[model samples]
Target: MISLIAADEVPQPAYSSGVMLLIAAVAVGALLFLIMKVKLHAFVALVLISLLTAIAAGIPLGDIPAAMAEGFNTTLGSVALLVGFGVMLGRLLEVSGGAQILADTLVTRFGEKRAPLALGVAALLFGIPIFFDAGLVVFLPIILTVARRFGGSVLLYALPAAGAFAAMHAMIPPHPGPVAAAEALKGNIGLTLVVGLPLAVITWYVGSYLVSQFLGKRFHVDVPDVLFGEVNDGNDEDEKAVLRQPSFAVVLMLLLLPFALIASNTVVATLGASGAIDAEAGWAEFLVLIGQTPVALLLTVLASVAVLVRPGRMAEAQSLMDGALGPICAIILITGAGGMFGGVLRASGIGAAMTESLGDLGLPLLLQAFVIATALRVAQGSATVALTTTAGLIAAAAAEANLSDLRLVLLVIAIAAGSTVLSHVNDSGFWLVSRFFQMDEKTTLKTWTVMETTIGLTAFALAAVLWPLG
Candidate 1:
């Protein structure tokens, strides 16, 4: 969503709309072949193809590197800090046994018969402030332990929790995809979180939880020994940390800390914009500053270390947070590269061409947003890239529509839904789940891919239904 070129600075088209569209198609095709077939790293593939696409689209050679860097830097300016801090919080929670505390309490409250539901509920809460990959990694041991105790397919315990994280990551803020999409589209971050939270829960319950029940019946995947080995076969006490684990109340409070802060800004800013409050008041300005997404998360992280970590274990806590950073470096870079690719498309006038073509097709803008995102997702395999590129493709039309903030957020939801569907071999997350669960490609296709499609369709259905109200 970052604009590399100002409105008046937009260059004249070098080719006809049809030709530019064709060039974009070919660029996407090459990008796919490189990543899915050649097994090139996504970061390398993105940067390479971005350069090539710029050349093919007739961007001046002199401006290409700056264009790429501008796109990359602008996106990272918003994404890296949030993702880094969120991952740090997640690691602190994971190593401190916070995930175990939440799952244990929830399962006890729900009783043994509804253990899967309890795990899902815990994941939904944990996922709000953490990225999908981080939350999933933290919960793997708990899911396996519960599945082993209850005696059923691991799918029963795993799918619901995984789906919850997926739903939140795709639709909610703080995670890079939706965060970047919100920034690109100029949507209200607070409102996107406000509208997206309940929609995600509903989408997960219907598309994921229910569908998981059906899949669990048909696909009986035994718990794998790959990660934990015979340790999972032993007592829960074996895996407990040496330190006294934090209570559920403390863990839940930590998770909700950012939400309370961010929501205050959203509420106050809305009231101020509508002339319901003194917009220029000192208190209002201070609330907005502390409520900034990165600032809120930063405050939460500091509070977590103080409350959750023992005074003597500061070094251990620091080490855990440092470990979290190493894994996310690739994710951050790939996201920045995705922004660069989208920027190139915009700079080359391909985005304008895409806008004109969508208009010629006469499809409603919401439908257009979903379909384009879906196609990009199915082709390239990275949801982040699809969401980023699709936002750029439609940003021109969205700006011209003069829509309200609510409608803009709905468009982001639609785009996210399109990106969420159709995960396959090319997606790293697919491989992560496949390896963790020890499922073959065929089984993964049946379970993960199908569940993803349902989630996407369900989200789009809700967004479409809500479009009129927006």
Candidate 2:
């Protein structure tokens, strides 16, 4: 197994644990001030703060760059490939009209009476491969169309849909938060998916769906005219004359392909372990290689593109793929920088220093995971940063807990669960919801903010409750 902790030992602290904790607090404060107040680009803020924190924590100046690089590169090794492939696959689905096809089919099948349910279902399917923001935007037109047609609270349709995307983005693979956390903490990618997808669906239903229904009715918000300007209903006469959308079945298959491939790796590896099948068998070995997270995602992207692109349109497809990569470059860099910050914290002996004390506080490992992630998430308002940083901070302590494979995966979800809580002004996602829904601050708080918290708490509760099963 790829251990979550880096190979090189953290140098002994030059200062006592209290001073080390003080330095960590001060450094984090500076990081927040720079990002939230000074409006520094997060990637820049993280890199600068990480370098300074290492020095303050008494890491040798000569070793600082290597330490940061160790975290950055190690995280990127897993993260870059999965994220890169995921976005490309999503772009193919987006540009080829696969998402639209799925949405239309969903609304048509479920009808406007159950439009909220329909949109939520569709969002869950599409959200698997794409980030939260991207999936929400893609579904916005469809959501707006449904809400307008239904002539009721937009929140009814919007909240459920938005919440679904948020749930998957927070917990599932191919979305950066869970993937990066898993990478940093040495959790298995295939296993995360194998377990996470079902966890996501169950919690989302219990939390995001149930809460949105209540809030949607109480809020009584209107659908914004500007968010999806001049959206046409499926009744439009020219619908057949426009671009040919992919079939709903095709979209569904493309979306599920990566999950299936990655899960196969877990299953086959399990059977091989039990001597039911030969681990070194040629067919099993081939399955194992392609079933690796990055490779599986790569194959899924290729398969999706092959199905999505039309004949004689290779250049156009290439251009769309290139466009997909551009927007994600910043996200990828920011994630790696977050890893650098985590790397610095690990190298400073904070994880080792805090392990015994935290364990003795009578806190369960799952609860500790949620609390740490929630603190970082609430303070900074970036789930990705919180997830990666918390993983680094607790990775050693978690390893020492030596929980079962099942429990360890649940802890990963618990951390992700904590990071999902309470989006506010500090969170970019807060603004994204506010502007998109045309809601003022108070309204966004009641609706988007609460729904996010609900989702987080629900997920955490489920993960913690599931811990005893391990």
Candidate 3:
């Protein structure tokens, strides 16, 4: 049957555990069909599916909208503010030629022979605050310019740079995937950022950078001239280039500001928990307050305006920040809807049933997180959706597990790793890389697909290894 009696009418769902599990499976299958075959917008599809699933699960008809709103509002409360501030910070850096400055300086330091390495490193630094798509698009011209200058496979320059953004975007907070996962799992955002930063860099090096070297030699694809043809590579004398680039120091400071602030908060909280310091003390409380993730990002955005924006350029700066928010509106809404779906699943008792089933199967929570996330990711695309949905699915189990904050953070990373693997035609990123590099689908699969899998596997392995320690 499509629905049982409402919870108000009947104290319990009419279906047995096996039937409820089947309903959950059908709901997920229906969602995949709606998104993949019907070509529905994810936001609309998620919201529609959430309502249907709620109805099927026997939630009272009058309570359905509030349940949806509760999920949506809870996610947005943690998500929307951070995303808005993060994009604003990213936009400030992008418009002010911060990416160019960082790239130019890194290339100069790393030398021409190691240009690819330099590009990758620069991308790692620049990608911290930006979304994957925005970061990739912003770095495109630089990647192309370097590829043309050195005259080798575009994969050499592109893969590492692209992979850096992918790593940071998938694993780290303030980026929607990790941020939403952290929120859904009730992980500490500060610790997520602190732990994720170094892990992303290490995984990117092992999975992406080294892989690019072999792939570069194997595939000798040329740079595409479609986007920015024959551009001067950061030439100060180019009359057409008007914006004076910010110094490397300014850019570096902006990038590090949030990390520093958030880390301080995490450290103090950790110390207090360990009985090393009085967390309730006024001094410690003050540090913790400033170190809060949203507060730190907000402070970083304000600092960017103060330090990066020159006198009388306030209007221009405002415009740049305004432009950044427009693209991310869809992302924010879709994420909230994903949360709504998760909420419905939890309220419908599917989460408890799945937890019990997984336990009977003897799967570890860490492994369960990765496997479920991977299934969702492969069935649909969009890492953010996979991350949020998986977090929601496991939230009940995770809460009951009563993991420490560290374990929760590690769990978030595991979920992120699962969402990242197996990008193919269904993933927009696969197409983005394909078209940007002018590679055919086959080549994209061999290069982008393989590299993404490696990155995901590497990250998951790291998280799993650390799970016991946490």
The candidate maximizing TM-score is: 1
Error of 3 at 289 (Å): 1.6
RMSD of 1: 6.5
TM-score of 1: 0.67
Error (Å) of candidate 2 at residue 16 is 2.9
lDDT of 3 by residue, 1-470 (tens): 00112212212343676777787778877876786678887678878988998899888899899878866676656556766786677555555666556656666778777988888887888677655654565466567656766688999999999999899888986676787788878888889999999999999999899998889889889887544333333343431133345688887787677767766776687678768999999999998898776788789888888876666767766766777677667656765675566656656666444434454565799999988777656544557766777788788899999999999998998988888888754355665577567776568778998998899899999998898898
* TM-score of model 3 (CA atoms): 0.61
Q: Model 1: per-residue lDDT, tens digit, 1-470?
A: 23323334444458987898788788877876887678898689879988998899899999999877866786677667776887677666656676556656666778777888777877887777655655675566578767766678999999999999888888997666787777888888889999999999999999999999899889999987444444222123422332236788997888677767866776677678769999789999999888777888899889888886665767766776787777667667776776677667766776556545554676788999998877656544567767876787778889998778989999999999998998864355665566568776568879998999999999999999998997
Give per-residue CA lDDT, model 2, range 1-470, as digits (tens): 01133323324566776777677678767876786678887779878988998899888899999988976786567556765776677566655556556656766788656778877887898677655755565455567656766677889988888889899988988666787777767788778988999999988898898899999889888887542234433233333233235677877786666656655675677678658999999999887787677887788778876776666666776776787677656656765676677667767765444432354566767888888777656544567766776777678877887767788789889999988997754455665566566776568878898999999999998897888898
Q: Which residue runs of candidate 1 sit more than 4 Å off their true CA positions?
A: 1-13, 111-202, 208-244, 362-456, 459-470
Ranking by TM-score: 1, 2, 3
Q: Which prediction has more favorable TM-score, 1 or 2?
A: 1
TM for every model, in the order presented, reads 0.67, 0.64, 0.61
By summed lDDT, the worst window of 10 consecutive residues in model 2 runs over 1-10
Pairs of residues at least 3 apart in sequence or in different chains that clash in candidate 2 = none
